[model samples]
Each structure stands twice: as C-alpha cells, then as structure tokens.
Target: MDNVSSVIEFTLSGFDEILDYKLTFFCLTLLCYCVIIMVNVVVVVTIAMDRNLYEPMYIFICNLCINGLFGTAGFYPKFLLDLLSHHWGISYTGCLLQGLVIYTSVCSDICFLAVMAYDRLMAICRPLEHSSVMTRQRVAQLVCFSWLAPLGLLSASTIFTSRLKLCGSNIKKLYCANWMVAKLSCAATNWVTSTTPGNVIAYVIILFYIFLGVFIFCSYVQLTRCCFKSLANRGKFMKTCVPHLLALFNISIASLFDAMYMRYGSSDFPQSFQNLLALEIIIGPPLFNPLIYGLTLSQIRNQVLHKYLQNK
Candidate 1:
C-alpha cells in the first residue's frame, strides 16, 4: 500500500524498441497529426460556414469529425513528446485523463455512427417524413446524447479507477487505456469477484458497446432492405449511406485491432508491429473520416472546391 502511494507515474513500453528510428517515426507522426487536424478542420469548417449544407446528416458528420479531433488530441501530442525525448512515461493523473479522453472519443464515434444510421434509415425509408422526424430539436438531442452519454460513462469508469491502489506502474502500450490501468490495481482479481465500483462500471461500459453494436447492425439491416426495394432508394443509399457505411467499416476494423491487441497481445510479436496494431484506431479514423466524408458527400466536396477556387 505504501509503495502504491509513492508511485506517481506509469512507464510506457511501446517506444522501447523503436529508439533506432525515433527521428523518422517522430517526423512521420508529426506529419500525420498535422494532416489529421487540417483535413478534419476543413470538413468541419465547410459544414459550419455553409447554410445550404445545414441538415441533420451533415450535422452528424460534422460531430464525427470533431470527435476524430478530440480522440486523437489525447494521443498524438504525448506520443510525439515521447518520441522526441525517449521518456515514455505519464503521470498517474495524466494517464487517467488520457484514458478518459481516448475511450470516450471511441465510444462517441460509435454513438455518432449509430445516430447517423438512424438518420439515414429515416431519410431513405421514410423520405416523406424525414424532414419532420429528424427535426432540429431531435437532431440536437441525438448529438448531445452522442457526446454526453459517453462522457458520463467514461467519467464513472475514471472515478472508480481513481479509488484503486495500483500495484504496478508500468503500461504495455503507447498510451493509457482504462482497461490497462484497471489491470494494474492491487485488486485486479477483486474486480471480477467482489463487484467493486470499477468492475461494475467496466461491465456497464462493455454492455453499452454491445448494445450499440447491435443497434447499429439493426439500423443498417433495415436500411439495406429498404434500399433494395426501390431504384431511387438505392441511389439515395449510394449517395449518402455509402460514406457512413465506409466510415463505420474503417473505424470498426481499426478499433477491433486495438481492442484485440490490448486483450490478447503478446511479447512474441515484434514491437513495431505491436505499435502499429495499438495505433490503428487513432491513426486510421482521424485521417480517413475526413477524407471519406469530404470525397463522398457531394455538397461538402463542392463547397470545399468552391472555397479553394475562390482562394485562387
């Protein structure tokens, strides 16, 4: 207990084997971070500035871009610093904060996707009623739920985590994660046996993802059925729903790689490969979401081109 009290930081081991290429990795990471910021900001600003593009679908897409920024911000700065200094450690408080930001951002990604799913379902299947059903008030409520629900869930997990007496001060990954931090507690076994607040919150978080996965699946299933029945509906699906589906697929694969690596990763794997697996979620979505949306959403793409042409 006393030793736990004295521990103030957790050492990250993800960068240990990359020291030989730190300079190259740092430049690549810095470039990647800047690109993520520029692309997502372009989509967000395009949507915000154009009143003609104001609609529920565009609004949700904008929120998704904002989330990509929020989630990546938790990681890239700290990672860049570690790459430069060769010091891969975070303060205990910093670890929890990072964990909170990263997890909530991921959760919010799924949440927004689910909301967008529902919006598409309404737009394509109930086109006549889409305007009334996805009203301003309703869109506002869904957007708030997408952010606030995850914030509340992750906050509870973080609060419960703060109560544990950590028995270890080393983390295996590049950034702190809630599950990794929870695994360090002296009461790791008790997290499963004694039903502590941390364990309860952890279970709820898992169940929430399960529910979201099912909700998204069902939304898309019905959407597919509706699209198949009519040619016009299929065109609508191609124009609008395809981008969301592509974004969902990309983020899902990246997130699954991350979750699988966290739970089942082994030292037998090369550190560089392991780092790639660990970083897939943060890297892929932040870069791809903006590109996916900007290219596929005709209104946004045209607006972006118009802005560029005007500048010229």
Candidate 2:
C-alpha cells in the first residue's frame, strides 16, 4: 500500500468460486430476481388499485414490497453482470452508494416490521381506538421513520468508512460492506482504535435491532394475551398476526445469518458456501416476504385471485 489513499476500486471475489458454473448460477439467480419482481409488483398493484385494501396494514405491506424492490435492485443487477463479464469490481463511490442502498433497505425493513407489529398490537389490544390512533398522519410518520432512520444512520456510517486510509482493495464476499471496507485500514490505523467512528455507530445499530426485536416480542406477547380472551381476537391473530410472525421469523433468520457471518466469517470455509451466506440476507427475504403477505392477507388474496390469478 505505497499510496493507500489512491485505492479507487474494490474487487469482489464472491463470484470466483462459481466461475465454472456461471451459466447455472446466472439462470437460477435471474429466475429468482424475476419472481421477486413479479410477485412484489402484483401485490403492490393489488393493494394500490383496490381502495378497500387501503387500511394501515395494506399500506405498510405496500411499503414493504417497494423496499424489497429497493434492496434487491442494489445487488442483483451488478451481480448478474459480474457473472457474465470478466471484471468483478465496483468503484469506491459506487461501493458506498451500493452499501447505502442495501443497508438502508435492510434496516428500514425492520422499521416497517416494527411499525406493523405496533399496528397489529393496537388493532387487537385496543380495537375501539385502533382507527383513531392510526390516523393518516400517524401512518405517514411511521412510514417516514422506517425510511429516514436507516438513511440517517447509515449515511453517518458511510462517512466514517469513506475517511479511512484503506490498505486493501479486495472484498472477499459479494457487495460492499462498510465494516469490511473499514477492516481494510492502513497499518497506521488500528482496527479498533479509540478514534474509530464505526465502533460507536456499530453498537448503535446493534442496539437499534435489539430494541426493535424486544418491542416486537413484547407486542406479540400482549397480542397473545388478548387472543385467549375472545374468539374474535383469536381469529384476528390467526389472520393477521400469524403471517407477520412468520415473516419476522424469516427475516430474523436471514439477518442473523448475515450478521453472524459478517462478524465471524472464516477463510477456511469454501468460497461458494461463503457466498451463499453473504447472499442470505438480501436474496431470500425480498422474494419470499411479499408472497407471505399476499397469500395470507385475505383482502389481498381475494383481489389477486379474482383478478390475474383466477381461471382464464
């Protein structure tokens, strides 16, 4: 690193393991991306076109689908091209922007899920006040919180990453991780120096997720408590809350995989296995979540079934 400051681009070797299987990987990846796009689009369109489905839950589901598209676009396009082309590198600025899109999308998802949990809690626990409490203004605030919180948090993190004097240009797994970039700091820069900004903000993000997980858990507990009190509450829980719990379980598993691997990934692991773990967070959730919401929510299922999904 004679001139470490001059490093302009980072090489992504996540695809290296599958070079011989590029055709198979590309086809599978492309098919997955296509289905994600198609399902999300259908769900969004169903929710938007049907005024009857304009409740807070549907509104949140719509935002979730949009964010799914937002998060996946950050990865799949560049990844698909990398599979075809010779080079597998992204410029520094591009890397920052990609990290920004993917991360904001990821964090915002948890925000939306938390908001949905609160919405469910209110609808079940305080049924009489649910409509008044979840006014248009309140819905707007929660939606904005979902998008803006992640944008603000990660923007600060990106600034810290951009200021580092990096000694390396290779990112072992796919896509740019701000922490991984920070991990490449020059010999003079200690990985966990007191001067490091990431240490503080990294804890902030961890705390944010922990707080949200607890919030969601508490909400569901309250929901479960109320469920036993009435047959109607039990029905509502079965219809709405159960799907949300399933979605949360899926996202938690995906995020857990990425977080654990990011913190403790081993060089001894096969590259293909490493790449699969890296992709777990971004790939599966986007494709599956909309399906979870769409198929489970009766209003959405009915609308879609009556329209495009019905017999010819």
Per-model CA lDDT versus the true structure = 0.89, 0.88
Specify the poorest-scoring 10-residue window by lDDT in model 1: 1-10
- TM-score versus the correct structure, for each prediction: 0.96, 0.96
Tens digits of per-residue lDDT for model 2 on 1-312? 343357799999776888899999899999999999999999999999999988999999999999999999999999899999989999999898999999898898899999999999999999999999999999999999999998999998888778777778988888988877877778435567733576788789889889999999999999999999999999999999988998898888888888777866645877777877888988877988899998888889889989965655
Stretches > 4 Å off in candidate 1: 1-6
RMSD of each: 1.7, 2.0
Count of backbone clashes, every candidate in sequence: 0, 0
Give every collision pair in model 1. none
Give the Cα-based TM-score of candidate 2 against the true structure: 0.96
- The TM-score measured for candidate 1 stands at 0.96
